[model samples]
Target: MGENIDVVVIGGGYAGVMAANRLTRRDDVAVTVVNPRSVFVPRLRLHQLVGETHDAVVDYETVLAEGVRLVLDSATGIDAATRRVKLAEGGDIGYDYLVYATGSGSPSPRVPGAAEFGYPVATLEAARRLRSVLCDTPVSAPVTVVGAGPTGIETASELAERGRAVTLVCGGALGPYLHPRARRTARKYLARLGVSVIEGSDTTVTSVKRDAVELGDGRTVASQVTIWAAGFSVSGLAERSGLRADAAGRLLTDETLTSVDDERIVAAGDAAAPSDLPFRMGAYIAGCLGAHAADTVLSRIAGDEPAPVDLSFPAMCVSFGRRTAIFQLARKNDVAVPFYFTGAAGRKLKEFSCESSVEHLVNEARKPGSHHWPKAGKHRPVVLAAQRGESAAPAARDT
Candidate 1:
């Protein structure tokens, strides 16, 4: 056998798993996936965990390729100069190529008393804890869900369907990325499920209490339980390791997904900012970037220039309980249009998208480069500029 290329992927989220699987396309590349957990957390169904409707986890044996090695450990640091990753348990992995895919998690809330009083739903343990709390709490308890993004909306609606009193407090507009029609559809379904949708500038949570939550506008919402789905925050390993990263700790990379400061290191999923513009955090985008990141490594191995990532959002789906949902069609640039599917049709589509994401990962595990996605035409300029080593263009804040 020829000399093997060691590719170490940090994180076992959708991106890491997909990257590990796809890296098997190369016969000379040995892939190792490092994660703290043994099982893959299906974050899409975490709300179902809170509702006790589904188990939001799957064994890595079912998702990861046979050629991939699963290391149950966390990456504590990275030494880009040495091409080695430090593990929390105590060893270092030397890699010819490294993939940073450590996904995001619920941030420690800055709001007064929030961290002490609220529950976050970004990981397996968090969801399991929240599910236990929900199961123990009385059905008639007042539950306040802070944030109106997909996680918050889905959690609130799913609980409401279970007969819990849920109030969805939006710090801003509900589903701000959704088109007006899609937003309307979401609101209708939420209202039908008896979820109180609180919006406007005053809806921001200022403080959390034992039995209530205080709003910025001096209003108090009665609640026996509070679920904090406000937003996700990535790991600080990149920033701490002196890797060039954005303010949110996402490693800054070129359009080809290669770290701007280090050609030997690439990044994927929510941890990667390509051309200074990170894609919206979701399973769909994560799976795509995972494949692209692997491709970049393969390109380097083959002595060819890695192609810039080509990606587009065909649609974004939001579930409003198990019975209803909203699938908002998007342009290539990911702007939600008026066209959408709602009710049961939307629900089915949402379900399929979730299922297909895992299926895509499994297929890639078995078939290597079996995954593919549409290209965004508008991203051409950005890609060209990145390849030319030009300055980064300003990015709009969407997700």
Candidate 2:
């Protein structure tokens, strides 16, 4: 018997939950997850919450391992030199190791009036606020959804399917991550839902106002409810703590998810920039990273070298309301291919993925070290080499 290792994981999103649960594998390690909310938020289904279709929250008891302690509070800063996490409320908690998995949120909008007038659905609180606002507004109100990313597309389509007049303002192409054919499919589906799909270089939102959104082309669209789904930004906790972070404020890490400056700290999910090249933000990747981060800590405790991250993307799925979706297949490198699944098939796959993301946490809670992900292909090394200005041969296939 020896002193138990205390590992504190900040944030209880997909990544944090997975990391906490997986860390419970060792009897000698104690895991504590710090989250602001008491319940787990199913972020992918947040649009459903705004549409009044789903609540988008799960009890922490259902997903968190019984051995893992759940701390209901936000982390304000990290005192890495003292190995302590400062809580927003008052005291700090010391940790032998720390997992920096604060996830992400809507960036502080810089567009004029956007911060004051626009509604973002990136967090549970934000989604609930938007849901309440939508409930109070008339169904006929014109809802303008900014950004053409998956969140924007889902929100617009969800509202439109609920009989609300919705306009999706895509600064550029719709579903920029999708193949051209897949993008066409998404556009067609949006049109079918009676959603006005606005696209093109000139369609960028210049400013958001109380009653309308101005466009780069000098056009103004009437908007009773303005939803900003443009993108996500990580918290400044790491940067505020004086840790090396990427330009996006994600903590800089090595290939093994260890902090570049301190091996005692690791990062996961959207808050981690491994090798200064982060994976695309999603629950699938987040869960894998969380599990890998746990393994890295366990390896260090056992005096073994932690293995580098080896995960690859298989596809990207975006829902159009509840009945339809587009599952765009991609290579291991995450570049979309020409093929895709849509209609009923895509919807089923998309729903399964959403469910499985949470189920991964629950399963990991019940059986630590049970989750597994696909290994990264040869593309990452070649890309890294090119970034370093070293010549490299092309990979035979990404997957």
Candidate 3:
């Protein structure tokens, strides 16, 4: 056989790891995952980490295939012309195909004093640091959580359940992704858990102080600790490396997940912007993107055209402490439906979703290409129409 196809995946998170394991399906491909850490961070449990309820770390040995190499280092840049990835620690590694899955981080807050006074709990290290500080804080101290996304809700609920006074500051609607009915149910559950839900256009933190958080409306909430979980931002490595990237620094790719600037470079997860539109950042979509990237490489090696990605969101889960949760069912377009799962049933489903995410990776390692998700209704018709050389409406861009 000729030289083996060297595939270098940058990142050890869900997407990168899944891509690495799935690449093992072909003996001609050798996968190397270069990440800043050796252990996998179960991002879904980051809130539990702050509550000291879960460690949220997984050994790579249990999730990676035997032939995949793990490089505990960060990618500084990529020389696509030479197929070489620059490493932060030192030298460079050459590859025949590159999977850009650097993922994302908790976005830097724009409010004054937020960076210096607020704590972020997006990664394992950050979560551990937040947990340590919480341990030192008095149990009765008022803690404020800014941002009403899933992370913000989960963090506030977790802290309230642990006896810390938590106030969820929603700059807008709480759980905007949830339908009005589902959101009402969630708010009630959080209220029962002793969490204060503040929702308003002017509720955003204008400034964060060591002892309090100032809102846009000039109201101040007494706080001993401030947790920020507003949004996420991808690294600028792709843009810096001269690759085509969107405004957020996510690598731009075609529908097949192949880089628009470089065909050999495939992107997945939050860092991938396909056709100027990116999928929402979540474990389910990330896994689907990762697996699709792998399939693209294998198809190329077999001299066949790669298929475009087809994915959908079945539901969204949010935990309001250990006992109460809400699973918001979605339509094909990802619009939350009025019907939903809540209470103990929702909690069980949330737990299952978290656990099964890990299981999906491990099972993929044992049997590549075993992981599969249903395609959204909108995507299926478009794809089929394209195959038949017929024009179709564009897929919905909303998450």
Candidate 4:
């Protein structure tokens, strides 16, 4: 190529786009982002398929920073020894600094036939397909959601509220990390909405077979649409690139978010597993780490010491529906401090929070490198004191 680019960001998700926009804002740096898609998928709001807010998203064309190049291709691997990224179609591009933010893919459901038949909302395409199937397919059709976390709960609730027969096959109680009361309350809400909650089922999804999912228990559910929302896995690109990855295949980084083997390489979002201070795969931490990664690269370029970044995060916000949510407050160290907000007012607060996060993305992307980050999340006095465990500790954030 002409010359090695300043920064090459992989995965055009929230973190990659934010970092590219920020890096290109400096005017002195040239940034290139590589991804397989044309648009930046708003993955967090994807569960509300039956609602208008379900389609919320920001196009990358409208927000990409100046002097930043967009390469439409999937990264097959990286030649870290030569500081080059191998693309599926756009060929090899060299870079001085690299940021991998490909995010995570939906973990394959383990129940028999789940892999072959389960529909997942992990990606924009998957969500779109699920939306189409639900809208066009038979109503009252049995739809089984095989997850109970934020995505699964929201999906099942949205489907059930819309008059669809939804069976939320929660592997655990709904909101397992939430306080006992919160979990009970969520279950009550779900039960009131005609959602069938199945808990403590040792589900082994063998594969997906058209319209039905077969569990290892030899039980079969006639689900016209089966969604797999259980866990996540990083793209194998990191492992293929010969980076220092962990057993789960996440790129291993230091407290400062630098690759353990190469300081010039940085990782954010689900693609990153920062040692001594790991973060969850939420967008909240991606924004923080994206900004931090940019700062680390900028400081190094300027021959200054890379400042240490504390994994300081406040809390997590989860939406149950359009008018209800749970703002789970945590400690400064990110343990749930038994805080909970619910009902209509809680829903409004959730709306405010989601809108504010969207606005921050737009503002920061529009300005490209304004060095803006979210202030810590505030909590209400109703902190659910009943929950003070390490599961709240998290497998742990835009993180």
Candidate 5:
């Protein structure tokens, strides 16, 4: 055999781990995963971590495939011209190919005093800190959760279920991604848990103080603890390395997930913006993109053209505490439909999804190239065509 191809995957999140494991399909490829933490973190379960229900970490030994080298360090930058990744702890690792999968983190809050007083629960470290703060505060203390996204809702409901006075502030509609029907159901469940739901155009948080939060409507809510789940943002590693990235810091790539500036480099998971359009950030999408990225690398190795990504979102599930949940079904294009499942069935589905996500990684580690996802037709091309003011090709239509 020829010299082994060294493939370095930055970030050991779902995408990086899956990409690293799938690369094992080629015996000639040597995979090395560079991550800050030794343990794998299930980002979806971060709220549970804050509520003291789960730790939100897994052993890499159980998820990473055998023979894959795990480097317990963070990637400071990528020197694409030299095919090396700079490490935070010093030194660099040379690679024949590189996968960019640095996942995401809480955006630097812009609201006045939010940076000083608000607590974000997007990443593992943030969740741990929030958990610590909650432990010290009395259960009777008023807690205000900002943002109506899944993270905000989950955190608010989890705390409310624990008998804490919780207030969920939605900048606009509750669960913007959920269908109206699903949104109503979610509101009902949250109310049943004794959560005060605040929604409307004027519900935006103007500022966060140590003991209160001011809303746009000029109302100051008493919040002994403020949890910020506004949204997530990717690291600046790509832009820091002089690579092109979208406004949100996601590394820009072609539809095949290959870096536009450097074909030798690919991106996956939440850190990747393909065709300037990224999939919804989640473990499920990350795993699929990871596998597709590995296939692109393997194709390059075999001197074949890599195929474009073909996957679809079927449903989105969010839990209300540990008992009730909502599963909003969507079309292949990811637009939510009126149909949804709630209550016991929804709870079971949400749990299954969380467990199956981890199981998918373990399965891929045991069997490389075994991961697969349903195709959503050529919807992206059609959408892009429409954006360009050009007629869509017949083949781009959904079948």
Candidate 6:
């Protein structure tokens, strides 16, 4: 056994990166991140697949703390009782602490052949697939996007800008988390870009076959390509490992973002569903939560009480294409209100969110004591190869 406890992190997304970057600030606790990938895939900018925003993929070697270790293996199961993670490979690694940040996967409703026929637009692999198809697929082709959340909106809008016949099928109000004004404004902006958004009391998608979507009201729309942009489903890692999970399979966390059953085992990003807040995972929250998770681990190692994590919702930018967009201002209790800004202004806000996430990671990695950033490593992909490739793109403009 090592003098300091080994902190094993699962999944290498925004939450895992932030957690790992913050956690290793102290010299006491050892950190190990197990993930299948090495690069910090910036998912928010993934909608650019319809466009040309490939510059968003981040390299983790520059952001991780000096001593943090990265392992490239797929985590198959978690043993909470023994504090050991069962890997798909031949080894079993034990951890003094565990952080579950497996994040979400593409959710498919029981809608006919949607699972088999639908083209995914969320995960990195899915985006890559979509990119390959889009680059080969003809412009003005019929692309059906289901779901009206942030991901759906970005995907549909960006696709429409490319002159594709985009039909966004929303089950409920568009951007339910966004304020009513913003929702209306978003609807209008989407329409302006030639996106046919179907939303009404009876508008619903019951099933989606390879060529068409069966609506709830017995209406059928031709969909050459269908994209599922529905809600997020927490990874099965925590659920299979016997950890306490809510209805959505997210690990139950306390106010400090650590698992309720185990103090050493914390959660971050989308995979962490704090019993108190029960967040609807986003990068804005993941980055902050990741930092806090790291801080808590470091404080424990220092024999000090970890600080409480308090996250409040503000506005988030929604890109409506390269030309049009909406700047939503979300209040404490309500959804984001529409600021009615588009073009460069809304794009600037979107860019700000990206910068804010990356900057927080860089600063917290350099200064561990400033604010609590947890040390969690979940992605063991290609980043461990030590490629210090700097961003060729301009510094993402801040808000």
Model 2: per-residue lDDT, tens digit, 8-73?
999999999999999999999999999999999989999999998999999999999997999999
How well is each residue in 301-391 modelled by candidate 4, as lDDT tens digits?
Answer: 8889765454555666667666677777766656666667888866777677766655555666678667554433322111212233222
Per-candidate TM-scores read 0.95, 0.97, 0.95, 0.87, 0.97, 0.88
Off by over 4 Å in 4: 1-5, 50-53, 201-221, 368-399
Model-by-model lDDT, in order?
A: 0.91, 0.93, 0.89, 0.73, 0.92, 0.75
Residue pairs clashing in model 1 are none
lDDT of 1 by residue, 1-399 (tens): 239999999999999999999999988899999999999988999999999899999999999999799999999999988989999999899999999999899999999988999999999999999999988999999999999999999999999999999999999999998998788878888889999999998789999998999998899999999999998899999998998899888999987889988889989999998867788999989999999999998999999988878889999999988888899899887889899998889989999998998999999999999999998865655655586677544222221
lDDT of 2 at 238: 92
lDDT computed for candidate 6: 0.75
**lDDT for residue 72 in candidate 4, whole number 0-100:** 89
**Residue 72, candidate 5: alpha-carbon lDDT:** 91
Candidate 1 residue-wise lDDT at 164: 93
Deviation (Å) of 234 in candidate 2: 0.9
Runs in model 5 lying further than 4 Å from the true structure? 391-399
Clash count of each predicted structure: 0, 0, 0, 31, 0, 22
Model 3: colliding residue pairs: none
Q: Which whole-number lDDT from 0 to 100 does residue 398 have in model 2?
A: 12
Candidate 5 lDDT over residue span 1-399, tens digit each = 139999999999999999999999999899999998989999889999999999999999999999999999988989988999999999999999999999988999999999999999999999999999999999999999999999999999999999999999998999999998889888899999999999999999999998999999999999999999997889999999999999999998888899888989989999998878789998999999999999999999999988888889999999999998998899999999999989899999999999989999999999999999988987877886786677753212111
Give the per-residue lDDT digits (tens) of candidate 3, residues 105-198.
9888888999999999888889999999999999999999998989999999998999989999999999999999998998898889889888
- Provide the RMSD of all predictions against the true structure, rounded to 1 decimal: 3.5, 3.4, 3.4, 5.7, 2.9, 10.5
